[model samples]
Target chain A: MKTQRSRGMTPAWAVAALAISAGMMVVTGCHKKTSTPPAAMAPTESAAAPTATISADPLSIDLGQAVVLNWRTTNASSVSIDGIGNVQVNGTQTVSPSSSTNFHLVAKGDGGTTDASVRVTVRVPVTPTAPSGEGDMGSDALFHSHVQDIFFDYDSYELRSDAQASVTAAAAYLNANPNIKVLIGGYCDDRGSAEFNITLGENRANAAKQALVAAGVPAGRIRVVSYGKERQFCTEETESCWQQNRRDQFSIDR
Target chain B: MKASRQGLVFTTFSTLLALSILPAAHGQDWNVLETGKSASASTRLAAADLKPTGGAADEAKHTFDATLYADLASAGLFDLVSKSQNPQATPGSQSEMNLGQWAAAPASAAYVAFGNFAAQNGKIVVNGFLDDAKNAQYPQIFTKLYNQDDSAEGARQAAHEFADDIILRLAGTAGIAETKIFYTKKDGLNKEIWMMDYDGANQHQLTHLGAISIGPRVSPDNSRIAFSTLDKNGFQIKVYSLLLGRIVAFSSVGGTNLSPAWAPSGQQLAFSSSRTGDPEIWVSDPAGSLAHRITSFAGPDVSPTWNPKTGAQIAWVSGRSGLPQIYIMDADGSGVIRLTDGGYASSPSWSPNGQFLAFAWDRKYGPGAPGGQDIYVMEIATKKWIQLTHDIGRCDFPSWSPDGRHVVFANDPDGRAEHTRVMSMLADGTQKRALTGAGADMPNWSWK
Candidate 1:
């Protein structure tokens, strides 16, 4: 509580700084952060409170198409959006949601908080275009695009024949692109405990990493992480959905 | 010294013989509190308002008086006789209490608490006495005097001390009057670590980690809180020192780390980390040095909770046998034993007395599930279990209170998705009460 930390940080450490800034605010004996106003959230509604509403003509739209979001606040001093930063209390903005996303409109006034949220579900595009950089990618790019995920059986993390084939192809791709470092993110279906899922997911990720290393891909080039059941690939209780969730998805590290 | 020792033994034997020959006092009306049967019929108590005696004693008297009554009622072991139900007696000392009258009639109170609180000359004095109305000859069972600062907080402290004394003598267990609870709350958007009283009062934010912080485990000494938060490293466990009120650096990095459990001695911390390949139980000091893997099983092992009574044993969840089950092992990872055999079980919390374990289990996990997850307590020696909650949507992360008489857990009472409220109940599944509104979860009771 006696000293304040310097908030300056490099780009690589920006997320860490902002995350730890919340803890630093407490350390400096202050509840308010100078960098950010207060954290934004869906404020609990109270009686006779500040009023806000976010409206849209169509709550659903085609992927990559724009939808106008109009907001109105009766007694708000300021308003902020999720992706689009702060805007006028009463204004309009065109948003092209790539996925099912919720736009939270938070209004701050003298009395208290006023918040309204609207979700827009993006319809699947009729014609699927090539993924980014796909049009001009060489074999390395093709390999990068072709790298597949390794799946696991229910409650099992051992690498199977099909998953081992995927890992073999992935290791070949990494061998061609020697400079590309990858991170393996493990995920699980929402079946058991959240805490247990962390370990199961990490073991899945490790199983993938071990396969790639056994196939001659440098172990140093791969890192492992577990999203557990937090970042699910599917939300249904069906076998197909659970199968899709239990896997190791690979990504190139920045 | 030897002659006095023989005389002391003779006096104790004589007193026990005399009490055994006495008739059953209060009959079946009092047997409910003495016998461990139908504990839902809690003990009846009447806390007479403290008589103010000196200058500036009104405010202190009010604070102490309300705090004592609230503590007694919240203990879940007593049916408090409200002020209106009292027999208009302000007995400040043992001589003033009329045992025969209180034992019968409208008051009908089996036990009575009478006290006097005075704040005079910048000092406060509290004199309290417990009277068992059935013991007519020796109605006075206990008395104590406390001297403290003449302040509001001091008054509350005196009440907590006095209530603990009464509970210890009557309930045969230590009271959680002074204990605190460490938990996580989803206030607005930020899920930060928070602390509150054992009775769910005086709640305030303890950590400002704006990221999603979960699984808060306070140290045995109440000096630090160990929880995991998602930062650039993705859910790295952080230790916040309560004394300095700041985050201290941890040596755990390079992978995901979470679910911290402190050994009762406060010397070692056991948590789950994937730093050495896969997530396994890792032990280290609070400063995060001397880290080593204690569980190197093929399957994943996580959520390690140490037996609070002894630092030599640990219990955790393991996915080794197809599905996750509760397992117990030595602190050094030897002498492993699987305590659970079927269904999905996690969040195994060892009771304070080391006689039982409380955990959340589905017991019916599959397609078309039969029942939702509920809290269950298992006896370590006999392997007997009794469900504490049933059909309550989903209840998880059950932690035992400091006295080991009750359990507090997070439940989606309304069956709403992802929303939960804090709840507590007796270990036998009686006297359930909601401790918090929506958006609070993962409650951990403090060590007394």
Candidate 2:
């Protein structure tokens, strides 16, 4: 019986080699795996060897996206995927792979053990870089991000020490980009009257502009507007929020 | 002899009520005389629902009755009797009215106002009467007849006219029921100009500009509205002509321009302009021609409001003395005098009689300040002020009603959300109520 079984397995090995080559062709085409054909078993054998095939619906996916892996096996008592433990004999599983991975499936049956593999490639998105430095200063978003807003004390337009530092840095940026004109909008907290705050906010803006001019920024390149209490940056009754509201916000003219 | 003496007293009282129709110089003292009178002396008046006569629609009669009752109640010169206390009979004319019923018991009304409404041939006709409830011999005070379009709006207009006549006879001042209020309403990220009736009815947008438009000041003639708005150039004053229903061409000086106030003569405008480098008070003709800077100070001077009674003085907000303060100067910008001693004060609105200036003041303005920004009315002569709003909210932009009996302002009560509302109240800070919903700002009452 053993001799006959060995002889039967010989032609099965040859057929297995041919099926493996064919599976390689399929794999090359669409990253799918086809199992080797069932070995030619002896007629007296109790069970046939398992045949398995596995494939990914979409073999490629962007990072942070999910992909479905489908596998089918015949004559197998148990089947298991490499990363995802045991699964049903014929089923699908969804996976969000952080990186490219190879999904390997193994099927075990009374006749033999069968295996298949599929590769899923995850594509990482590329981020666009922002234009920076002198020539690129024309963008308003870049200008505002670089120049900081200066805050004032309650009901006072006098530039505090920290506000002066902000003004100096802003003047440096303005001087570096001479063609860029700036608009200084003065804002105030909601604590005071809207009408009185109009003048107060204007004074705060003018105070910043004067400091910028003193720091060598041209006065003609700067325009000022007072939002008064009409537009408040922070509505909280807290002191910190009020400080945020009383500020000289800088923006590009265009 | 006793009848003649009573007739003489009635004639004298009628003369006092008619003082507003006199020349400007004589009318200047009208508010003083009226203010000296006590509110306790307000006449108890009852307004009966309008009776629907032939072909009068129920909706029109309902509108007329509601408007008439609201006008008299809000007039600030009448103790309006509740509708529940009214007699069962709704008199449509003098013959149908029982004055004794209104003068006794729950109503005890000194005067009874009854009216009838009729719609015929696409026209609305109303017969309104006001009678002294106690004086049976001379019960009739006045009778008014109104004929207008057969619509709810027509009924409302007729009711307003009758209410105005009643207020004039009883309060000695023009009624504000027929007046309009121009304000700014937030639209998306922008604010547009809006107008509504004095009682917060018929609110509609006037300007469709999808930009920030605020500080609306209607012209004395009710023909144009001047407001500050952002454009491609910058902050500039624009005029909306009510006659043409479009924006009229106004000269745009290159700089920030804001807070356009119309002189009572309707020929000049006072505004704040930064055209000359610093924000200063400037005056120009109604057409924005012949513009000249009247103030040339280092600090910002803005929010110019004219003394409507005299048309000779200008009150504005100035920042020259550290914090902003209310200051008054001549029309040409001479004889400058500061009215507020300390704290933050601004948005001075001159009363029609030139006797008081209503403004916003933060008496103790600072971080974690104890008192809130409030509205105050100051007697321009004595400089003694009365706080009109107390800790209700950050109230500002107090615009006096045409009759000088009420003030309209903007109140910001919600702290962080920045939801602001336009509010109105009597000059004494009583009967406070909101005129517009949240996001309404800078209310300016019409001259009429």
Candidate 3:
């Protein structure tokens, strides 16, 4: 061991000098037994303490938008972000937060541990003010809440008892707001051919329209379209999901 | 080979006269080339790379060769020889070709198709020829000259025309290489009409309506496309004029009107309308005038398709008896005959020969049943049906090619609309190929 150490002494000293200049204390241990003094270990132990800093680009974003968080650490052997778990010592990550969040980063090393954090503000979009004259009753939200979509049986367009009640309520709403026009879209589950479903959807829409008309809603006030199986309310293969899709949804024509 | 027997002609004029005379002479044997014939029974044909004459011709040569090869291979008439087995030499004329090499060894081609491409004065010219490799005495089958503007598309068009002529001379039927397929592609929440070459090239959007459009049926004259779309009024049938490059005004009959199908005569359209308080079959003029209700059934009658050959019968989907089924009626709505007794069937497209109807049918249409929606062809006279697509996907909207050899349809392999793709296959259900990436459906092949 002594002979091998003596033979590699010149290159080892060059590596130690380069390591010391670069502020890397780990490589100095390579030549420690040859010529290193005990006092040199003091600086190595003190430098073992880690320092970390984190920053977020823009620091604020609207809901649904993403913000980039970049972090850097010195002398740290391990690093992690609060929400993101473990991460590289220095890197950038993109995150979309639904609410305001503080990205906390922790760095740990032999000497000590250090932490830093950057807060990103997420701005929730404000809903636009509804047009005047209609009040809450005329708003689309209220209409959707009151009118409701009427479901149907598979391969059948006949209105059930529940569907008939929905039709009656929708007709009453249409009668109360005489100026409002309604468009009924019939949708089907993605089980059959799109062509057949198209006609089936039309049948459902027309059935709802006929019931509305029978309930004293003017036929001219309502228009019907069959979305068929093109648009789905739910896409699961389960019966419950498919039942949700086979329906006549009412919306404001305007 | 004798000097006089070398059938090489460079013509600067009378190109149309040559094309007219050649087909009349060689069109007798096309009936022997039937669909569903095994590849081993098909004529072994090889397409050589087009020899470029000028620097600019080199740029378009690759397109010409690839298009020509694809056209012939997809014709379902010939067993195409792969390029790897072809001889290295690209013969531009009969004098330059050595038939013995193509007939021997790896290629063993029965017939060889060779062409020369040139660019002159902003025009792309192709002199294409097919030769009987074994018959040195009368080797030439047909020689066609195609000239168009100097561009990659021009080269492709020239190739399509030349390949079509070759198919006509050899198979006795018109080739679909130069045809167009119109379909609906989803754009965000809206579906717009799109068009592509029959070989799935040159795909481009035709409509930017930002509204839902489906069921595009091209006119027999290829001048207009009739489709169903959603507007402020409701679901309506609109005619898009290809010549005008925009949607033309069609008189709407109010209520929900959808699925407009053109008669072979191109004068009348058959569609389903709810204007009379129920969805029924309606016949109208091309401009949606002179509209008259034909089917006064209790249930909805939709997706009307006319017998392309006779135009005397209209096959449609009717829901009069519980579930929707295929039914055929006379042009005036008399002589009603149910085609599919049970099972859900729709989108009945009549073959060009007027003998069969290709439609989408779910034979055992119930939850957890192994029978899924697939394309099927039903013989109207016999009521014997053959399932074309087995279980690859849920295939629908099967439209027959004008030659009655192929069917193009939409397939949803993953059971999602966003994953739907336009697919085409031989009428026998072989050679299935996806023509679009995804998010496309309701394919309508244009009538020649």
Candidate 4:
């Protein structure tokens, strides 16, 4: 082993035989092992065996803020985020959600696949300094930020219990703030025809106005306008999003 | 490919009228007789890109050609021959056309529309001609000369005018080309009134109110658009002057006002108002000099639409029966007769001839209803209605075209998305065409 440089003096025939055997072995070694790792199993059966949890660092975020998504998986060979691409089984991703977004994760493993989703809600920054016509803007701005909008069921103008409670609170507020005139803008989820939505929105708005009047606010002080589905609060195609769009926002118009 | 000879060809016009007086005589007979339904086979028609003979900018001719091609394609009656299939010849005038090529195989166009345009001296002079490809001698079936503003839009308008004439000459029905569709286009939270040509060309916002508005009914004379707008206080009927392009003087009915319908007389308007304690139909002169109640139903009554031809009869929705249904009566609320059965129905628009009523109806309105909201047309004489749309995404706000041959309506084609679009179809429910893309709603077709 130590006399390696002097191998040429050993034997010509021996070297030839050694080279032939080495060539045969090298030819057999050129088999090229598979380049593709087997496809990630879809985890069809008993997918519930694999559980995934996607937790946002902050459940809610300001419009421009970012949320760190930390996901952990058990028995998952591959993990994919809804807005984010495939990632390691356990990792964290930072996403700046402009609107309420659901981060859906599909966890795959030998047993099965599981679906887990986490929501990040975006809060629109209230602009108080924006020009809003007259000093009425002050009341409008304040009411917009503080007053709660009364929500309605789909295609229903009649007030629900929660809506009635909000209307009661609004009635008390209107009575206290005698100088402020409120405009009840009724809206609808972007369903149905706009024409009917006009009528539907009107009914909703008027329903709110009538409730306020019945609660002792002067009928003359309350103005109602139905934006219909025209002014959609949420354009997303989801029941929860649409529910947010169907509501009556109280604004001080004059 | 075998040529479809489904439409009746008027090749037997043995009497050749003098060329000088042909314009007056051209309106007598069309090649295709109206069968009151879609043709067994679509008419194979071709259009030559308008040749620019006048010294106008290139943009004018190109738009005129493009719009004319698109307008004809949208006519629904024609199986328009593609520009690539058509002969590379822009027939400048009717007399110069070679019909043999258009009638030949591969380009077996039953009819051909050719035109020439010139933008000169601040005016666009257009010469449009439609010819029967099978007729040798008197091949010219229709010809019209239009002088409009020497701008791109004006040129397109000129093209629309000529296309209307061609459609009239072929379909035996007046085209909606000259008419405008008044609709509301959604921009963010603001829905504003907008106007477009019948073919959805040249869509421009008519109101900058920066608010929500709907139910834009253009006056019969195209002078004003009566729309409902949300102002600071509440919703009111607002009139926008086409001549002035601004919100002009309109009746300010107290309380919430919506659904403004213009009378063909151009003297009156009918709308629904909640001012009288309950929603009711009210009519007033356009000037708002005074207003009178048209409906005094104890329950809610709304959505008044007038017969565009007579203006003497009006149809509206009444909820007095617990469920809304269409009811028609004299403009003064006399001789009231219900037009729809006991189902949820609204938005009744009368035909131009006052023979039929088109409205949105939910025939199976109850728990576990099987069908979606559909459009129905009722014959005034028999009180019988036929469903025009079936499960075509909550179709509503049915408005009739000026010719009475088609209906323009708002349909939410994409079911759950909540976005609706303007669509047009024949009165019998055939040839359904989407007139506007998503977000355009409540299309009210203008009268002739």
Candidate 5:
């Protein structure tokens, strides 16, 4: 029976492999070729050339530290840093050391040829560097602890800087969890008329979902619903109750 | 003399009752007194000259000319000639007749008045007319208003008294603008109390609580509205002043207070309370003081409506007979009498004329299968019951128009799953129409 079952699954596995190979090939075809500099102008990974440098580093970094990079070439035209890391390029065209650094830097010559390399180092600040809190709460506990809130700007769902921060954190957590699906429920305070608030609440949930997708979270994992001001946590006419009620809550289905 | 004035008051009150239940008519041409528009040719006539036929009718005509214009215009029937037609003229003064210009004016009909005012037996007498003739010397009709007693003091009553007479002569029915109906609407998450004209126009929500409100009743004089709303101590009875825009609440000492019914004189209100444990009928003065328990039934008793025709009688919903049923009793809660016997019936709304009672009755089966919740009106005199609605839905909250010809209510046969709408049907259960778009429920028809 086991042999027969394995035989039945073989064709499925073959089909999946074929599909994945085709996708990879398509992706490869879209890449543009970068011209290489003359051999004499080849800059070592640590050197900063007159041309721009390709910056790279570790994905995680500690706060407030220096990092170093090893490279061999100089006279770089321009150098630019990209992604979320702090680095300083020295006269030697190499990334300086820092308390915690992980980034990629590319050095280019005047002819447009580039030399790129990655450097990583720990830069711990006040708190100890720890892994993500996902594992500590167990899937179910973590789901409940994940505070999903969509802040508003004085009766508006327009995204603000602080709102982006909250959505970013939520997206990161969602990206780490594959098996969980979440429903984003939007709510509003009792300020304006009832009918207007219902539509406003809907817009808020949609905005949060949009933020998550931009942050690399899968679209299929998030569903949105608006309760308007229907289910207010408090019935008081005070501003405090209104603020608390005008938020979004994320619920996960196991 | 006092007795005659009381008679006039009764006549005026009865006219108000006449405006109670007007049916829904399509494309009604309401003749509003165009505030900033040109005056109707009839405005040139004196109250006495505007009257038609007898001198007795003329006196009444002069008494309620303003009320006649307001009621007929609001009913979407007669157009009121603007009172401000001649802006330079004083408020109480009349304009001089431009006979040729008046005749050429754009009115389908004209009213001209001329009369003598006299004091008789400590009462006042005024004659009126509705003269369509070119000269005021030859008037078309005449009406009279004679008050033999000086006990009554309000000008509103006298206005309606004369307006009623004019309405009968012109439209063959009583006018309704001077009357009013108390109702409730779902304002966002909370139910709001409101009152408006009889034609489903002039709507204004009265309450703005962060809590739920339900069931409102109007006083006979159309001055005060009584309703129930939830507060810190559960649901309580509240009386709202239509003129003052003020609200007075009556908290329950023992149980929840709800479903208030106004006495004919507008002096006291009867309501249902659970203060003694189970829902029972109780009477309290308009001030919410001097409470007296009326019913001693074992089950919940609610939905009280006063019978204006009867001296001191009321109709209410009682669950004493296993299911909700309609019952009638004396004003003081004595001499209990059963009205409806077949099935579940609640939300009793008595007609202004005291001829019929409209209520919500539950059918044996749910919607579509066969039976469902329906609106029904039963004749008080003959005990004849007529089912007003029959379909796959349920209808509740039946309120009568002052004319006793129509009933407005809310229908949600599908329960809370669908939108509830305000609907109206003829008193005989025909020509049902939905006024509100959708998702609206618990409508209270205004007598105004």
Candidate 6:
């Protein structure tokens, strides 16, 4: 064995050395000038742990307008919205707040007690003035306003019985805000074929349109578009990401 | 041979017309060679000599000419010669053709396509002419598109479409635009034959037996199908008439009888069977009344497809060269010659043109994961080849659409379907559309 090894060793070791040198060359070749330390790593290391923040879009909501409250926390083990008798989390529950009601976001973490609250004053949504009719589009046309977010169940286009209340609420808003058209965009999770999902999303959006129109919202005030599973808010391929995908976003036009 | 014959014919015609050089309609001039009586006599005599002449060589040439004319006429692309039999005149000349000849060759119109199939740029190119012979003008320049990718088994489809287009252009009616392919699909643990539209729609199972079924073939009229089904008893050929929607044992022949293809007249089917203790192609009447053996190859000779334009010729895949290769021979199984040279190629489908054969070429590689199956096309004359699919996934059982412009095959689009799904693509291997239904395979394109 030793004799045979020695006979093939010289050339083999040379090839081995060459290969090692080639690999080292590649590694060292990638070295760049040590500029300032990476800004991203430095900020996270020095700053206090990123605490979750919760806030409503509008601090003070006029009775009818929706105050979208959002929350996030790096340390919180579990966090949810509490208080405000009928405060809803879109898919979770329905919210019917009064003057004395406050929306509470209780977040518990390893560091300390952290709580966020939004005092939601419930009132009838206000009616907006009709367009002056000076724009390129007609006042009754769909191009002037937008709808917000709609929701759906897991892998379903059938509007759940629970979703009707949200649809009714949005319809009431549309009824008050005349001359504004809203576009309802339907979406589906990244589960099935894209083509199938596109059809499903379209069906969901149409269902919403049907419900809103039936609820007294002008047919012309609602337009439906299906984005399918295209605009995923979360890139992760997890259940949570999928949950976020089954939704419809509303956008109002001029 | 073509150039020499062209030279001889051209020289002879030119000498006869040397006296007059007045240009005719197009660029060529008509000299009215010996205009008055002698010219008339020459044609009369040529027309009077109707008897087929000479030995095998002359007979073969005459057959080739007749084959070409019949194909062109049926293709609705050429004029047939019904004038008195012109046995004296040489092939390809006006002496044999009377202006008023062949008035009944379908719609009072005849088209002649003359093209040479050759290997070009690593692929086969069949470029020909669509001549409106009666009108004395070129209708269109027809081309049979081919690529090496399809040479494995799709050449027949490419050629069929090329021929169909000739008929469509001249008749203003789609030719063979309705036809279905019958093939076996892997269903669960067993392979079963299934049928579907030419575009891979409305796919349904034709057999539900736990036994294995393979090699389903559609009849010429697209009304019936035949295939081999294996039972504990043994392998047997079964025929299913679409009109009746019933399955029946065909021929009661002992042993395995498979790979049945329809004749042009839809009167007979050419199939391979081991009833004689050796696999060979046999032609049988629809009633299975007359069984004639067409092949006696020592090795396995299967997957036989008959030429629609020539009742006397057939194509089948033979494993004579250690590996399966396609071979074309007389309908009686004479004049056998290997047409393909590659690995594990089988299941040949004849084009309507009688000019090409399509078949599957299964390529095997070393251990880890085997290579995929592909469709290929081959020109009968020049033996040029084109390969069709290259996806890593297994692609098999290609069925040509009725129009012959597309081929439908079964493949797992996701690369890993526990069960296969049917997919189709245009003849050129573009515009692939997957069928939406769940767990589908063994798709046959229906003539409807």
Interface Cα root-mean-square deviation for all models: 2.0, 2.4, 1.9, 3.3, 17.0, 22.5
lDDT of 6 by residue, B192-211 (tens): 77765343334567777766
Candidate 4's C-alpha runs over 4 A off are: A1-254, B1-46, B49-59, B77-96, B104-111, B115-126, B132-135, B142-144, B147-151, B170-172, B363-371, B390-392, B415-418
For model 5, the stretches where C-alpha displacement exceeds 4 angstroms are A1-254, B1-166, B171-173, B365-369, B413-418, B430-435, B445-448
Off by over 4 Å in 3: A1-146, A168-182, A218-221, A251-254, B1-42, B54-57
Residue A253: error of model 1 in Å? Answer: 1.1
Q: Give Cα-based local distance difference scores for all models.
A: 0.74, 0.78, 0.79, 0.72, 0.55, 0.51
Better of 2 and 6 by DockQ: 2
Question: Which candidate has the highest lDDT of all?
Answer: 3
Off by over 4 Å in 2: A1-146, B1-42, B55-57, B232-234, B416-418
Mark the 10 consecutive residues where model 1 chain A has the least summed lDDT.
A1-10
Ranking by DockQ: 1, 3, 2, 4, 5, 6
Better of 5 and 6 by TM-score: 5
CAPRI docking class of candidate 3: acceptable
- TM-score between candidate 3 and the true structure: 0.73
Model 5 chain B poorest ten-residue lDDT run: B27-36
lDDT of 4 by residue, A160-218 (tens): 99988888877766665555688888888865445556666777788898898999999
| Ten-residue stretch with the least lDDT total in model 1 chain B | B8-17
Candidate 2 lDDT by residue in tens digits, B44-159? 88999888787535787788889999888776677789999999988888888888899998999999989888888888888888899989998999998988787877888888
The alpha-carbon deviation from the true structure for residue B268 of candidate 6, after best TM-score superposition, in angstroms, is 1.5
List A-chain TM-scores for all predictions. Answer: 0.45, 0.47, 0.47, 0.45, 0.44, 0.43
Q: Model 1: residues >4 Å from true position, as ranges?
A: A1-144, A148-154, A158-172, A231-247, B1-35, B38-43, B51-67, B79-84, B89-96, B117-127, B136-138, B145-156, B187-190, B414-417
Please, what are the lDDT tens digits per residue for candidate 1 over residues A1-254?
11111212212232223323332233232221111122222244332234566655366666567878777665568889887889998999888765656777777776466566666655543312232331122233554565788788877898989988888888877766564578888888866676888788888988898888888888998888887776677877578988999999887765
Candidate 1, B245-312: lDDT as tens digits: 99997878577898989999999999998887767899999878999899987788889999988888
Q: Write the per-residue lDDT of candidate 5 for residues B149-209, one digit (tens) a residue.
A: 3222222355455665665665566665455444556667676776544434445667777
